[model samples]
Target: MGHSLKKSGLRQTRYGSGSFSSTYKFALLISLSRLAIEKGQDSCEGLALEYTDIAEKFIELYWKQAVPYTFNDEGQLILNQNNDKQAEIVNQIIKLRKIYSSLELLRRDSEEWLTLLKEVECTVKKMPVRYLQNINGQNFEFLYPLDQCGKQLILLPQVMYCLRQFSEIIEELCQKRWIDYIRKNSTNAPILNQLPNLEQFMFEPSRNQLNAVASVLVELQECKCFYCNKKMRKGSYAVDHFIPWSLYPSDTGHNFVLADSSCNSKKSNLLASDEFLQKWQERNEEQDLVIVDRISVLGFLTDKERSHKVAEWAYTHAKENNYQVWQG
Candidate 1:
């Protein structure tokens, strides 16, 4: 019975207040967009009561962006609570967690979050929404997306925009928390890196890096996956970090490799096992000749040593921290 959102329904400039960025608001929009698309058939009926638990999705988003790993000498990455023990980092995480745990992402019976949720919700709900009410004490039924809402033309642009916004925020916060944590503790460190945010590249890659990973990496590797040495094609390949970008923020020619999509996704942001690392090293050495031209064209990094130091730093961290390198 709620009134439909109007073109000017948005009130808050963004989600979260004050110091917090619009990350949560944007992420929820992306999540909501996904939920709607997934349940389009029923939702388009304008009465399916398409339900979702926004809180859960927000938590998952938090972990995917914030999770950091410490490695043991065997060259593997593992979770280390101690790494997040610093009072400042711990406080940041605590604050961030409170933001997640107390998210007004979904409308609740409590009047406080409901208004915030409504204001945020209108940013994406252009079409008529029948209603929104809690069902099982936790889950919320977003109920009904008019025909216009289901159209890809309307939906796709919003989805991509939300996703790009989501990725930028994730990239910023991930670097702020985890990378900063590593830097403070590792003054004498060899090579610590930030995990490659695969989403960022796929969706909104840096203006400074190889904008064409499939073609460039294919040429570099002779159309072979850098990890498995398997043949690849434009659509079949995944661009991966030779040194996980979760460990290193830099994305340049020397650090990139083409891999089977399955292999790259499996690796996620984990450090590669010794075998793969050695292979990566060899590939890096071989690509040094053409690196300048390729990277310079993109105007990213021309220094091959930056990539080398990153690799060295990553391996040394794995060696020192006893992190378990990802094997699969």
Candidate 2:
């Protein structure tokens, strides 16, 4: 309902709910939709994803709730999740995820969560032919609750809303759970690992960009790092993708810049922390004739407008949720 990129019309889940909203039910489905798309290639048939490939993918979204902070005279914070505290936070997040996956939701008196998913499958089977696609392959097997990995999924017209809802549901659920766990008056002291970090999720690691391209950006920036205005040596600077490669994997020319190796490393895959949002946007907006010529020869600015749109879409979500962007 909030936002969607669905191709077909929305199909309401037959079973109603108070425990989970209709939007959330679709959110769950949407998360699955994303998983299927991420693992498979586009084809006339549809897209598919591995069943086991889910956990790692889910973890990326699972940690979206833990926001981090650094204290100075007032408090402390770091550019990335390099500290022991962050590690503990990640460990506990994984632990909770294991517990969560094990939960059967409505089947307290019966089987696992997959039982309910079976029922979900039954409901879906009755839907029209388009939504009732097949999922059978040697590489794919039913994951239960979810589906067989690499199973083709036919997304509805409101698909984007469904995927967007998955993130929203996750952030809300994680915060509420963590808050309840932390605020409860249990006899046991809160295990630091059990206590979720306040930092939201950061994107996963990506392959490094080409050095030839990195050097070109260095010259373009007058040797000043994009994140920090500091000078960077020719062979020392790292080329960073402004809108993380995880979020937007295509290697766009305008999306890259030379930065202090530390800054590039520290920024990791998180969006540029809010402070640098202006500079990042301004750099993207630079389209002078001379700059355009240089960018054309050294790198590719295939579609500046589209690139900016993708960045703004990512930043919009972060800004709305009060998630901190990375600043190294």
Candidate 3:
């Protein structure tokens, strides 16, 4: 299912819209732009993959820190320290603007570095605002739903009020990251606000983001392949996008499938259905095998061919997996 909005949801409110100081905004944009350029590579089309990289790094380096920690009954640190470390790194990053400027200038001439940075910038500029738009109308607090890979708009008025209060700190960090980067880089470099392609707060997740999603799935399934019923250690499997990213780039969490890499790649973008069932049956005598296909970005899914194919695949998969089929 697609993302939904709650009419009475007060969670969609923006915090302090006018609160970000010029310094913070500029610093934040710069940091994002720089990180994008440094960590991502350019695609065949010349656009940098930095947007993907930044998204990956953002989640990797900072996602945990952004989360709040609670203590246990024994007064031990019950929460993940990884998240705490991320927060610390972020704080350090806030301080790096002043300290790193001098060091950054000395290394500006490295062609390899410059090339990488440029690529990152190219990618970040193309990310869509759809992710960020989910926060509109509420306290301006939105989370990239870790489990769902989408966003959840808050609805409780109290939560909304608290989010507005919390945004002051988060927004400060966001702004600081931008300003610091600008100060460190040359004026000739791209200005973040001026980038026509810049998305608001939403970022197109990178492969790493998918990995994180995969990790969550593994945890959900106790580190086993959803299809093969095998133990999946690190590097033994991949999280499949039931709807391939190329075909349905906009989808986040729900469209994901945890499966063996070979099985996933075989089904890429091909509608799961009866024909697939026939082929799967032919390949394996097991009647319990369920087959899934990758979906397309174009055309109405309800169209005869697409719908039939999907239905066939889903039914077959259900039967094979011994799972109940809940029709949407």
Candidate lDDT values, in order = 0.45, 0.44, 0.34
- Clash counts for all predictions: 25, 30, 29
Off by over 4 Å in 1: 1-204, 207-211
Q: Please state the error at residue 10 of candidate 3 in Å.
A: 37
The sequence of per-residue lDDT tens digits that candidate 2 reaches over residues 1-328 is 3222222112123212212211223323434544433333222233333423333333333243333333333532222221113333244444444545222122232453344334333333333122322222121111221243224333333333344434434334433443333223232123333444432223222223256566567667889988778987767788777877655444445677778888988888788876676776676676444345554443243346546665666686678677667756
Question: Which candidate wins on TM-score?
Answer: 2
* Candidate number of the best lDDT: 1
Q: What is the TM-score of each candidate against the true structure?
A: 0.39, 0.41, 0.26
lDDT of 1 by residue, 1-328 (tens): 1222211112121211222222343344434433332233222223122222343333334333343333444443322213223322223334444454322222222464444334323432431132122122232332222344432223322333232223324344433443333333333123344444235422233433344655676777798877777887667777787777655544556777778888888888888888877777676677777776654445243457656655665576567668777886
Better of 1 and 3 by TM-score: 1
Which residue runs of candidate 3 sit more than 4 Å off their true CA positions?
Answer: 1-204, 274-328
> Taking the tens digit of each residue's C-alpha lDDT, what string does model 3 give over 1-328?
0022222112221232232222222222223333322322222111222234443333223222222222232322211212113223334333433433321231243663344444433333322222232333333223222233232212222322222223223334444443333223333123332433212222234455567566656765577665555786687778765534432223323345576776666665543444433443342232111121111111001122332233343354346556432121
Task: Please say which candidate is ahead in lDDT: 2 or 3.
Answer: 2
Distance (Å) between predicted and true CA of 236, model 1? Answer: 0.8
